[model samples]
Target chain A: MTTLAMTGRPLLQVEGLTHRYGSRIGCRDVTFDLWPGEVLGIVGESGSGKTTLLKCLSAQMEPHAGHVVYDTREDGPQDVFALSEPRRRLLMRTDWGIVHQHPVEGLRMKVSAGANVGERLMAVGARHYGEIRGAALDWLGRVEIARDRIDDMPRTFSGGMLQRLQIARNLVSRPRLVFMDEPTGSLDVSVQARLLDLLRGLVADLGLSVIVVTHDLAVARLLAHRLMVMRAGAVVEEGLTDQVLDDPQHPYTQLLVASILHP
Target chain B: MTASPSLSLAGIGKQFTLHVQGGVVLPVLAGVALDVAPGECVALHGPSGSGKSSLLRLVYGNYRAQAGSIAIRHRGQTIDVAAASAQTILKLRRYTLGYVSQFLRVIPRVPAIDVVAEPARAVGMTAAEAERRAERLLSRLRIPERLWSLPPATFSGGEQQRINLARGFVVDYPVLLLDEPTAALDADNRRTVVSLIHEAKARGTALLGIFHDAEVRDQVADRLFAMRPPSMAA
Candidate 1:
């Protein structure tokens, strides 16, 4: 479904979400509902609180104010901020997947590739040696890696492969809501394009609800079904992807769109 | 006798009962039928919530169907996926089905090479043979040699996706289901995936896929199936 269409039920709901780093506000009065299978792009320039807001939503940081309600697999709503640390972590491992901008931050460098991917499955309580190993291999191939390197460590992989591997690890169990912070920000242009395409397909195929924080309008335009433009810790504009990108209503949005440095 | 279609779905219907919503039943798909012949590729295209992914899951036996028969032919055996027992489905999946989705799922602490080689290992291939195949595919996909010994947990999105592709293709299953197989691949890597898919097709693999990229769809798909979202269709 088109994200802005409001057909599917909202998987995540944010209300008055405000956070601050000391005196500076990270995000102010942020409110939105992310529908199932929708990709919501939070776009802004660097230092626009996009990353800050993502951290708050992903439960990486505690917000000074606000409520982030997530629909659990059991069809019940849980306030993310209210959950205990262990419960929150369990949610992160089971129902939620997070992709970090820096690949290293998301992956465990000491573990082997197979273990990296397999850990997600194990986190969800998957046992049976043969089944686990086989699923791990299948996921490696799905992410485009060859199977022979299942025992290798993450330190040996290139930057691009590292990011891919992190994705494999995060997504192996098929999380319902995936929070991505500049998932392809460090990659080269060609690599970014490939990652974006892969992400779009995965989002669609899995019916995943994604909230991706990005400064690049192009990244938002290509992968996001809905756009939310943030500036100085506040949402300046929000709408459907085409409406927000092709025709801007706010002066700041107009400036952001106009300033896009096309390749 | 003529061989049955590689995959056949007849009057497939799926409805989800929303117990939380006063037991409301939403019909996601209904009266859907399709077939894929050996060496042919079929693509599913539709707006979001149109049940394209659901159909794939149904064929893969990940989702149970309310109505319909999903028959996949392998080794002259026509197994009805929708009604097959769990053990039957498991056996069929071990050797006959291959799926490539956008994300890669590997076991933690395993090497990238072993992750890719496990598919062949599942179907009774020798460990050595599977590892050799994994090496060749990894090199062909352009994964660095050094990474072969490392875990993919720290690899980038593109690299992880390549690992996933290698695993899916290693088994050379008779019926393959691909969901955006080349979405994360670069131009060169995309070309490599294309060739791999072509080779799979040449080997008489029956393929069903969903490609958001029109270029890739055109290059590989023999037909397209359009689906209407459940809301509209209902």
Candidate 2:
């Protein structure tokens, strides 16, 4: 296959990335470049190391080998693993976002949705309750959450609403890069579809660079521009989403696509 | 016919290698060439396995072509679809090229109005303007106002096809590809589509389509480009 000649520098680059759980391989030698305003999907069955690769890329877990470089606004390209802990935390709070599969893992259940969103603004040094509340309300509307529900605790929201709230909170800061792990995994089928649509609109509008890990091929198809198919802790296939799904070159990828139960 | 072609293809070839079938190669299209001038409509006429849809997919950059250039006029320059990067293809799809496939593939929960308006909004139309255009098209396509706010997944097959048509025509794309667009539409809706195609052509849009319905094809297509299966051609 010919290499795609992209014009600008990639937003994020992962090279020879590897991670290990004890002696067992979690993910091995995974590498890819993510461009601005692009959604790259990592797909595989359970225990295929999709989440492990995501954890390593998002700075949650240090990889056993290789470099994960991010194009910093101030410092050009810097290795994320080499950044100071404080700097990495600040980067996570300001420039990066991670949406967990379960909303509770990413949200504060006890706080009102407004505060949950406002706290990110405060972290970024946005003062004045009026301004924070106003921004919170605006983001709520964008995510299809009612403004009246701004004061309601997350526990009061449904599974889908909770997910939407989580997205709103993460996006409120306007993070350029977002890492989502099975964003629609826990919701009902109909709810998942709606959230997927909402996410698609937001991603396009914001021009966000996203790394989404999903096992569902349909979700991958809807959200991803490029896809990496993993098996046995290694990337078995990587290509454009339609190409990988429609005419899979790898044997494992062909099986995976063939397994999808189309209606 | 004097105006330069808005879209042109040369020596386009496509073949699928079935990896699971012990590396058997199936050549679908070979040495196919065509052009659609501005304000003109060209229809693909062929049998089922004649690679008509494959040709459209190649032009749209959905499938990579093994050989040849699929050049499209975009932003006053020619872009080779077969060689352009994904980003370039996306930009073309957003501003210059539009496609209407047989089925509507959208997020199942979005309202029919939003589904149609989304592309318009993507091309820099304000929310109100996009929605307004969407409303007009939806009503013109005979999708009732009550059904406009509901997801098309819940609508009948004909209604969904109408929604798909509305979305495709929402943007005045410089070039449009239609794949069996009116397949499931009733006579009234098919007539609406024919008028839409005429309007697009009047606006200097170049259209390439596979119109299975003979009556609709006769009404919209300015010329027919015959295609044959590779086996038959051999």
Give the number of the best model, judged by lDDT.
2
- The candidate scoring highest on TM-score is 2
Interface RMSD of 2: 4.6
* Every model's TM-score: 0.53, 0.91
For every prediction, compared with the true complex, DockQ reads 0.02, 0.32
Q: Alpha-carbon error at B222 in model 2, in Å?
A: 2.7
lDDT of 1 at B13: 94
Task: Estimate the TM-score for candidate 2.
Answer: 0.91
Candidate 2's error at B138, in angstroms? 2.0
Q: Indicate the residue-level lDDT of A251 in model 2.
A: 82
- Give per-residue CA lDDT, model 1, range A231-257, as digits (tens): 999999886664566546566777787
Structural RMSD, model 1: 15.4
Clashing pairs in 2: none
**Can you give the lDDT of residue A258 in candidate 1?**
74
> Which ten-residue region of model 2 chain B has the weakest summed lDDT?
B83-92
